[model samples]
Target: MISNGVSGNKYMDGPDQVVPSDTYISCVPGGHVKLRQTSRGLASEPPISVPGLLKRTAARYPDGPALVTKKADGKWHYTTYKQYQERVRTVAKGFLKLGLERYHSVCILGFNSEEWYLADLGVIHAGGYAAGIYTTNSAEACYHCLESSRANICAVQDKKQLEKILSVRSRLKHLKAIVQWEEPVDTSVPGVYSWAQLMEMGAAEPDTQLDDILKSISVNECCTLVYTSGTVGPPKAVMLSHDNLTWDAFVIGEQVGDVKPTVDKIITFLPLSHVAAQVVDIYTTLSNAVAVYFAKPDALKGSLVETLREVRPTRFLAVPRVWEKMYEKIMAVGAQNSGLKKNIALWAKDKGMKHHLARMNGQNGTTCGFKLARTLVFNKVHETLGLDKCSTFVTAAAPLSADIKKFFLSLDMPIMEAFGMSEASGAHTLSIYPRFRPESSGLILEGTETKFGGAVSPHGPGEIMMRGRHIFMGYLNDEAKTREAIDDEGWLHSGDVGRLDTNNLLYITGRIKELLITAGGENIAPVLIEQQVQAELIHIGYAVLIGDRRKFLSILITLKSKVNNDTGEPLDELDTETAKWVAGLGSKAKTVSEIVNTKDPAVHKAIEEAITRANKHAISNAQKIQKFAVLPKDFSNHTGELGPTLKIKRNVVYEKYKDIIEDLYKE
Candidate 1:
C-alpha cells in the first residue's frame, strides 16, 4: 500500500503497469528484472522486531564489540552485542516499571549517545513509541513535540535539554517522569530521575513481563514517531510502525549490498533523531552486526580525527555539509602551500581528476600519470583526511554537489549520494556502487514505485511520488497532513522534483514547495541555482534563493569562517593555517559578525563571480539571481533556521529576514 506516487509522464517506467491495488508511475529502464529480484528480499527474510533483531545479533556475536564510545583519556569503552542486548532489555523493563502504557510515546532528547539509543530501543521493546528530539532544538520546538506527542516519559542527556523540557513542562499534560543521563542533575526536582535509578528500577521488573510485552506488540502498531525536517513549515511527526522500520531494516542491505558484521567499521555520529541516521546506523548495525562507534557530542570535532585514525571505518555516512567542510579544509591547506609543493598539489589533483574520468568511462588501465598523481597527491590527502580505507562514503539528507562527489571519487573514495525524506522511512534512492551517475540520486530502491506529477515530462522534472515497502504509516495525529501527503492510491507524494533518465538514473531537481515562479511565468528551482552558486563560490556556507513571486530572483548568502565548519568552533579557535589564509584575504575580523558583515571586497567579488556562474545554468532570465546579499551569520539548527538534518527552513528564514529581503527589492 506504499508508493512514491504515480506518473503519467512519457518517461514513466514500463508504461502504466497495474500494480495490485496501486498504479506505478514508471519503471527504470532495464529495471524490471533487478527491481523484482531485489524486492523479493523483503519477504525472503523472516519478520523481526527491533528487540528480536538485537537478540539475534547478540546471540550470534556475544563477544563481538557492538557499541563503542571514546573517553577523555583517549580510551575506548566497548559494549559487546550480548551486553548491549541485556542493557536494552533492562532499560525496556525500566519503561514498564515507570508506568509507560502500550503504544505510548516516549521522547528521548539528546545527541548521539549509548544511553540515548538504548532508551529508544528499550521504549519500543516495552511497546512504547520513541520520539527523539534534536539536542539543538529551541525550547518552543521542544515544547511543540513534547505537547503534541502526549509523551509520559522523557529521557534527556543533560540539564540543558532537561531545562528545555522543564520550561514547557507545565504544557505537557501527560508527561510524568523525566530521566537524566548525565550528572549534576538536581534530582530533587519532582519527577526527575537519574539514569542509574531508572536502570535499577528496570532491573527489578520481571524479565518475563518485558518478553511478553514484546511478543504482544504487533508489527503494524506504531512504535516510532519521526518528526519531519520541517524545511518549509512546522515539523510534523511521521508515524512509522514496527513493520515499517523493521521491514527495511532487514531488506535495506539487499539494495546496498550486505553490511558484514564486525568486519566493516561505522561511526554513529549523526543525530539519531533523524530517520536516515536511525536506519543507517541503528538498524543497519543490528541487521548485519556492524560495530558502531559513538562520538561524544561535545568532543566530536576534537575526536573525529583521532577516531578516524583509530577506527579507519570501512563505511562512513554524512550530510553534504560535512563533505563540503572537508573539501574546504583540503582547499585551505592547498591555499597555504607555495612553490613546488603547491604546484605538485595542483598537478596531483588534476591527475586524480583525469584518472577518475578515465575510470568512469570504463577504462581499467589508467595511465602512469594517474597512478603517479594518486601516489603524490590523493593518497596523502586520503591519509590526512582519515579516509584511506573508507571504501564507501554515503551522503544523504541534502543536495550533494557533484564537484564534491567527484573530488572524493578522484581520491579513490566512493561517494555514493542518496535522496529521501522522513516519510520515505529512510531513502527513496541510493546510488549503486562502481557506476555512479554524477548529479543523480540513483536508481529507485527495490520494491519502491515512483512517478512524476504536476505537469511533469520526460525532460522536465516533476514532484516525485513513491510507493514502496519503505514508506511510513502516516503523520502522527494529523490526519489531514497524512491524507495530503499519502494519496488514496497509497503513494507518498515526495514533494521533491526529479526526473529519471533513459539509463534509469534519478536526478532530483528541487522541492515542489520550494519552486519559485517569476512574474513572467517562469518556474525556477532554487536548489539548482543554490547548488550552482555554492559550487562556484569558495567560502560560501549556504545560498538561499529569494524570489517567490518577485520580478527576478535574488539570493542571500552566508560565508564560511576559518574554523572547522563541522565543530562550529568560535573565531578564536581557527587553526593556524586557516587563520593565515583568512588574514591573507585581508579579513581582520575576529568574530563571525565582523567577518561576514564587513564590506570585504574579496567576498563581494567571490559572490559576484559565483552569481555569474549560476546564471549560466539558468533556463530563463528570471531564473538568474539579479541581486545578492551576504548575511553575517549562517542558518543553523540552534538558530532555528535549519532542521535537525541541516535542511534549510525556508519559511523561517524568509520570515526572520523579511525586512532584509524587502530591502533587496527597494534598490
Candidate 2:
C-alpha cells in the first residue's frame, strides 16, 4: 500500500512499495515502483496529468489564445483555450472510437502546426503514447520508430508524409488507420481518414468511453515517446511519464519569471520531435497559458525572420546554427554600410558590450553612454530582427561558440545557454537572463539534484549525474540500456563531462565518447580546440579535429558555403559573408573548387596564420592542431555529417575524410 501525495506533502512507502533507495521516496500514483522514485520534487505545485493540466488551463483562461495559426488565406487565426480544450476532447474521443488501444502508440509525422499539437495531446488523453517522427527522417527511419513504439494509428501533416507512411504501412501489422491533416490527400486508399472525418467520427461517439480511460490514468505511466537522433547507433525510444512532462514544464516557467497568462507568447519552429521543443513550445506554454504561434513550413529556408517580425514573441529558443546564421546575415548587411554610419555602428556595439558586461558582473550599467547607444544603434538592430519584445533568448541542443555569444552580447542581446537531454524530459539546467553567467549552463532547476561522478573534488570535469522528478520513465523495450543509464542509486548518469563552479553553475566540457587521447597519455576535448580554430578564422563554418589515439592533432576545415534551400545540401559556392571576406583577402576565388584546385596562396596564408594564432591558446602541444586541410564543401544535414540539431557527427566526418586525415599524419 502507498499513500497519496499532494504538493509538498511527504508520505511513506508500504510493504508493496519497491523504493529504489532510502534517500528517495516514491510519489508515483498506484503502488510505488522501483526505478521511478525520486528524491527531489516541487513543493509549490502538485503533480498533474497532461490532459488534466490542459483542462485547468482552459478553465482559467477561457478566452485567451492558446494556439495562433496562419492559414493559406494569408491571415492569422486564433483558437482560445476553451476551444482548444474542446477540440482536444473531440480528437481524444475520436481516437477511442476508431479503436485506439490503451498503452499503444500513435505516430505523428509533420512540421509544427495546430493539427500536430492536437494529435499529440489527443493520443495522450485517450490513454496512448504520442510518438513524433522527425520531418527529415526517411521512410525506413519512420518504420523503425513506428515499429519500436508499436503504433496502431498514424497522423501526418501533409501528402508528403502520408506517402512515406503508406510506403511502410504494409510491414506494420498493428497499424489500423492513417489520418492526414492537410488536404489534397488521396483518401481513395482504404483505412485512410481525413481530418474532417476524424472530427466527424468524434462527434458520433459518446464521451463515456474516453472518460473511463481518463479515470484510470496515472501520472507515472508513460504518455509520450521521444526517439533519439541515432547519430552513432540505433535510436532508442525515450519514455516520458505524465508527471515528468508536467513537473518539468512548471519549473521551466517558474525559472523564466513573469510568464503570465495571455501576456507572454512564443513562436515555435524547432522540430517538436526533440524534447526541448516539446517542453518549451507545448507543455510550458500550456502550464502558463502562454499563446503559441506556429511558424511557416519554410521558416528555416528564409522566411523565419518574416514570421518573427509578425509575432514578436516574448521568449525565443533556437539551436546554435540558427543564431549563427542570423549573426552572419547581420554582418553581411553591415558590410554594405560605409563612412559615418559604419563608425557609429561600431561605437554603439562597443558601448553595448561594455554596458552588458558591467551588469553581468553586478555593477551599475545604466549610464548616458549606454542609453545613447541603445537608442541610436541597439534599438534599430532589435527592430530589424523583431526581437524588440523578446525578453528571454535561449540557445540549446548543442554547445554554442564563444564568438557567437560575444557577438550577441555586443548587440545587448545575451543568449542564455541551457543543457538537457530526452531522458530528463527537457531542461535540467537553465540560464535565465540577469541570473546567467557567461559560458555557464546556469543553475540547476529547483527540484533537481546534480553531482559530478568519479571526480576527485565536488566541482569537477566528470560525468554529470542527475536525479529528479523530471527523470524519464525508461527506454521503451530496452531494460538493459535503461538500467545502464539510471543506476541503482536513482541517479541518471549523463555521459557528458562537465564541471560546476563555486556559484553552482554547470559548464559542459565535452562528451566521454568524443574525447581524444594522445600517444603520450594526454586527454583532450576536441570541441574546445575546434571552436578556437573557427573563432580565429571567421570564414570557416566547421573545424573538425582528427586525432583520437594519434601522436598529435590535425583538423578538417570547411569554408562557409551556400546550402540547398529545399534539401539542406551544402553547395560549393561561398556564402555572401564568406565571399566578402574572401574578396578582402586579395583573392578572386568564388567557389570552394576554385580555392582548392588553384591552391590560392592568399587564402592558404590566412588559414595558416589563423591556425598559428589559435595554437597559442592551446593547453599543451598535444592538444594543438598540428596540421589542417580545407574540405571541398561544408557539412550539412543532407550529407549526414550533422545531426538534426546541427551537432557534428564526428564519426561520420572521420569516415568521410579518412584519406585527408591520413595524408596529414603521413611521415
Candidate 3:
C-alpha cells in the first residue's frame, strides 16, 4: 500500500513499488516494492523550496553519502547529507550577510562540480533565483542571459569567466557581486569575493536568520532560469518553479522504477546547467537512496572507467554521442582482431542483424538458434565494454539509430530512447522498460497530452505538440516568443515532424521547418532520407538536403572523423602540406574507388541503394540526392556548426558552404 502521510492510498501498491527499510517508502505509482535496507525515508510531502527540500532530506538520512567528488589524488571524497545541508545553509547565510535579496537572480557560470550545486542551492536558499549559464557560452551570449535575468550576483569557476563578467559589469547595473570558486586571480575589478572568505563570513553570522529566509520561500515562486541552447536564435530563459522541478523529479523517478539514492550511485558528467542532468542527476541525490559522483573535465575518458570501477553505478543517462563513440570503439576493436576471433565476431554480427530485422518486424522473441549464437558469441562483447553492470540505459537530445539500439539490447542492455526539449523541463516521453519499441520515442508520459497540428499528409506526419505540468512558465521577458510557442489551448508547439503509430508509439521523422517543398509542390522531409542513408554507412557525419522549391533534391555531407586522414596528426605538419596531400589523394580516383568498393562494400552499396530507397519514400520530384559533396572535416560544437546539444545549425552550415551548394545545382 502507498501512504500519503496524511492519508493511505491503494494507488501506490504494485509489483514495481520500491520498498526501502527504515520507514523509507518509495512513492512510485502502482505501489510498494521492498527497497534496500540502508535506504532512509525523507519527507512524504514535496518541499516548497530548495532549502526546505535539502533540510528534510538531510534530517531523514544524515549519514548517507549525498555528494561524491574525485580528488586530484584519485580518491573519492564523500560528503554526507547533513554535511551538505550545513554547507548550503552556511553559504545562504553568507549571501544574506552580503545583502542579497528576494527575486534577485544569481548566475552560476561553471562546469559540473560539487561547489556549483552548492552555490546554486545557497543562492536559492537566500531568497534569490538561480540562473545557470553554460560554460561554453560565448561572452556575448553570457552577457545577454545575465543581463536579461537581471542577475545581481554571479558565481564563476575561474579567471576566464570572471574576466568576461568584469568586461561587461559596468553595463549591467544590477550586477553587484562576483563570487569566485577557484583560487584567487589578479582581478583589478571591484566587488569580487573569494568563496573561502564568504564561507568565513557565513560562519560568523547567526543561523536563525538563514533558517527564517528558507521558510519564507513558496513552491509557486521561480527557482531557476535555464537558458535554451539557442540553436535557432538568441537564447531564451525558461522559467521553472519549485513545483515544476519537483514534479519532473517525481515523474522521472516513477519512470525509472523508483531509484534509491543511498544504494544507487550515479556518475555526473554532463553539464549541471542543463535541466536533463540537473533534475535527473542532482535532484535524485536528495532522495537519499542515490549518491552522485563527479569526474574531472579534462580526463573524462580515463576517469569514466576509474569512476565506474569504483562506484559501479546502477543507472546512466547520457547523450547519443557517447554511445556513438562507444560503438565506433567496438567496431575498431573488431577490425583489429584476427583468426577465429574475427570470424566469430563476423558470424555473430550477421546473426545479430538477422535477429534485429526479425525483432523490428514485430517478432515476439529471438529464434532458438539466434539465442544460442548470442549466448555463445556476443556476451563477451557486452562484458568487455563494461556495460554488464548497467541496469537502466537512456539516450536523449538527438534521435538514436535503430542499429545502435538493437546492438545494445542484444548485449542485454535495453536502452530507453527518450524525447524532450528545454521548454519541457527535460522529459516528454520515455520507452517503458522490458517493453521498448526501437525507432520510436515511446508513449507520452502520464499527465502529459500530445497533439498534431498543421496539414498532415495521408501518412499522418505533422508538427508535434504537447501540454503538461512539466512545461516551463515562459521564455523570460520574451512575451512574443512565449505567446507564439504556447497556444490558446495551452499546447506547446514543438516544431518537430513526427507521427504516432497504431500502437500509440511516437516516431520522430524530422524537423517540420526543415522540410523541403519541391518545384512540383510536394513536401519532403530530408531527415528521413538522411537518417536512412547515414545509418547504413559509417563515413557520413551529417547530411543536409538542398533543392528546396528547386528542380531536384541534392545533399552536402560532412565526413566522419574515422575516415579523415588528417585527424590526430600535428596541425603544423598538416597545414604545411595539406593542399599537396589533398591533390595527391584526389589524383588517385581509381585507387580510392577500389578501396571504397573493397574495404567497405556495405558503405558503397548503401550509397547506391539509398538513392533507390529514398526515391521510393518520396514523390517523383522530391526523390533522391541528385548530387553530393563530402567534406573533409566533421561538424562540431567547437566549429560553430553544431549546438552544445549536437543539433546542426543549418544556417551556419549553409552560409559557410553556399558556393559549393550553388555549384552542385549548376548545369
Candidate 4:
C-alpha cells in the first residue's frame, strides 16, 4: 500500500480538507481544478521518464530558441532547439571518445554559463552521471566532492577553477581528464583537453552513432548528482534520475501556466549548479524551447539592464536576497533624489499600496487614481528595475518577508513564493498568480502528498513531510542518511518547521534543526528573527541566535563593513576625522562600537525597527533578544562562518564567537 503516512488525521482524508479552493488554484488556463481528490492507489502506473520527455519536447519544438548567451564581443548569441541537440550529441560523442563510459561521473565546476548547461546535457546524453560543485568551494571541498562521487573527468570554466582541480590532482586517482572551457596559458597538465579540440573531434564523428546512443539512453539511468549546498559539513551528492528532472520541469511548467517561448523570454543568471536555477532556468526552458539569456557575472547589474532592454523577458526567477537588494537600491535612489521626481516616486508608492490592498481584498480592477499613479510613478520604478515587462516573478530558496512580498505585489509584479528542496527536484508548492496568498507558500502541487509528523496545535506548526513522483531516487552511496531522510514509506522528511492555515495554505516558520530550545523550554526559530531584523539592518549581514539551553534568545551579528564612524561615510577619509569619530565611545567599547556603527541613522534605525517588528511576531519568551554583539565583518562561505549558499554554519559561528556569546548570556 502507498502509505498516506498520517494516521487518524481527519485533515489528511480528502481534497476538501487537504486542498481548498480558497487556498489553491489551477496552474493551467481557464483555472480548471488540477489536484486529485483522492490519492492514487499504490499500483498506479509510473509517470513518464525524463529522457523521454526531453526527446518529445525536442521533437515538438525543433526550430524554437533553446538558449541565448552574450558573445565575447558583447552581442547576444542564440541557440535554437535543433542546434542545441546537435551540440549535445557532439559533446556526448566527444565524451565517449575520451573513454567516459556509461555511469562514469563527470563534474562541472563554474558559475552560470551556457557551457555549464551544455556540459550537463552532454554528460546525461552520453549516459554518464553529471555532478556540479559550487564555484566558491575550496580545493579541499572540491576534492571531497570529486572523490566521493568518483568523478573521472571534470569540466571547468576558467584558470581559477583549473588551479583548484590541479591542487588535488595527485590525490584524486579517479580523475583521468580535465576539460577546460576557456583557453589556458599552460595546457601542460597531462590529459588536459581543451574544449575546442574536443568539439572538433566530435564534429569529425558520424551522426548515426550519436543518434543511436541518445535513443538507447533510458529514463531510469542516473543523469545528475547535485551535492547539497553544505550549510554545516561536507556536501551529500543527491542522485537524480532523468525521470526525476523531467517530471519536475513538467510539473513546475504546469503550475506556472503554460509558458510559450514564441511569446515569452526568460533571463537566467543564478548559478546553474543550484537546483532552482537548473530546473527552472535550464530544464524548463529546454522543455518549452524558451529563449534563455545568460547575464554576465562581473557586470550583472549593467548586464541585467541591457539584457532586459533587449530581450524584454516575460519571466524571471530570483532568490529573496536579490529582491531585497533591489528594494534597497530603489530606496537609496529615492533618498538621493530631490524635487518633483522624489515626490512622484513617493506618491506612486502610496497609490500602489492602496491598489495592492484593494486587490488583496478581491477587487478585480484598479482604481482610476491607481491607474494614474501607475502610469506616472510606478512605471518609472518598474522600468528602472528591469521588471516592467515581466509577467512572472518567482522567489524561492528562502522565505520572503511579508512587507517585501506586498511591496512587489503593489508594483503589479506578483512574487510567487515556492517551497522545495534539493531532494525533490526543486519544487513541491507554488503560489499561482491572480489567486495567491501573500503570506503562504501556496498549496502543494497536484501529484504531491503532504503529512504532518505530529499533532501541531490547532494553528501552530509542525514538520513538513512530502511524497511525490518527482522525489529523488536517493543520496549517492549513503543509504543510512537516505533512510534517515526518506522513511520506509517513501515520505521525504523536509527539515523545515511550518504551519498550515485553516485553508490548508502552508506557511513555513523556519528550519527544524535550527530551532533553539531554551532552558525554560521555549523554542525559537532564528531564521524568523533574522529575516525581520536583517530587513531592518542595512549594515548587518548575518544574525545568529544564541542562548540555546539558556534563559532567553541572544544574538551575534556580523556587520556589512567596518567603519571608523557611525556616519555613513568612508573610513578612508582624513586621519583626523577618522580618529575623532572613533573616539566617541569609551575606551573599552570604542574600537568595537566604531566598527559596528558604520552606516548612517536611517540604516541603523531600520535594523532596530526590524528587531522590534520581529519581536511582535514571537511569543513572550521568544520575543526578548536580551543582548547582542556585532562583529567587524560579514559572515561568508569563504570566511568559514557560512556555507556556499550563505546558510550560517551555526556550530562554526558559535565556535568563532564563543566568548562574545558567553558574555551576552552572562549579561
Candidate maximizing TM-score: 2
Off by over 4 Å in 3: 1-48, 187-189, 299-310, 346-379, 454-461, 562-621
lDDT of 2 by residue, 80-195 (tens): 99999999989988888778887788999999999999999999988889999998889999999998888889999988899999999999987999999999777889989999
Q: What is the C-alpha lDDT of each candidate?
A: 0.74, 0.84, 0.68, 0.69
Report the Cα lDDT for residue 605, model 1.
70
Candidate 4 has a TM-score of 0.84
Question: What are the candidates' C-alpha RMSDs?
Answer: 7.4, 4.3, 9.1, 8.8
Q: In model 2, what lDDT does residue 267 have?
A: 94
User: Candidate 4, after superposition: displacement of residue 373 in Å?
Assistant: 1.7
TM-scores, each model vs. reference:
0.88, 0.93, 0.81, 0.84
| lDDT computed for candidate 4 | 0.69
| TM-score winner, 2 or 3 | 2
Q: In candidate 3, residue 552 scores what lDDT?
A: 81
Task: Give the per-residue lDDT digits (tens) of candidate 4, residues 40-100.
Answer: 5421324444445556657887777778887879787778777777787788788777777
Residue-level lDDT tens digits of model 1 in 181-212: 88877999999999999999998877887766
Best by lDDT: 2
Ranking by lDDT: 2, 1, 4, 3
Residues 1-667, candidate 3, lDDT per residue (tens digit)? 3222322122223111222223212121111111111222221333334565677778888888888987878678899889999998888888877767766788999877888888888887776778888777787888987888878888899998888888888888788788888886554557888888778988899988766655555554456778887767888887775655766666677767756657777788877788888787777566444788786664233356555556667788878767766675676566578999887766776676667556656776775467766677766665665555667788887777776777665555667888878777788888765446778887666667788886543223577888765676666656577767777566778888788887667888777777788788777777667766666554455787787878888887654532223222111112212223223444322223333334334333445565566566554545667776654356766667776656678888888888878877888
Clashes of 1: 12
Q: Is candidate 1 or candidate 3 better by lDDT?
A: 1
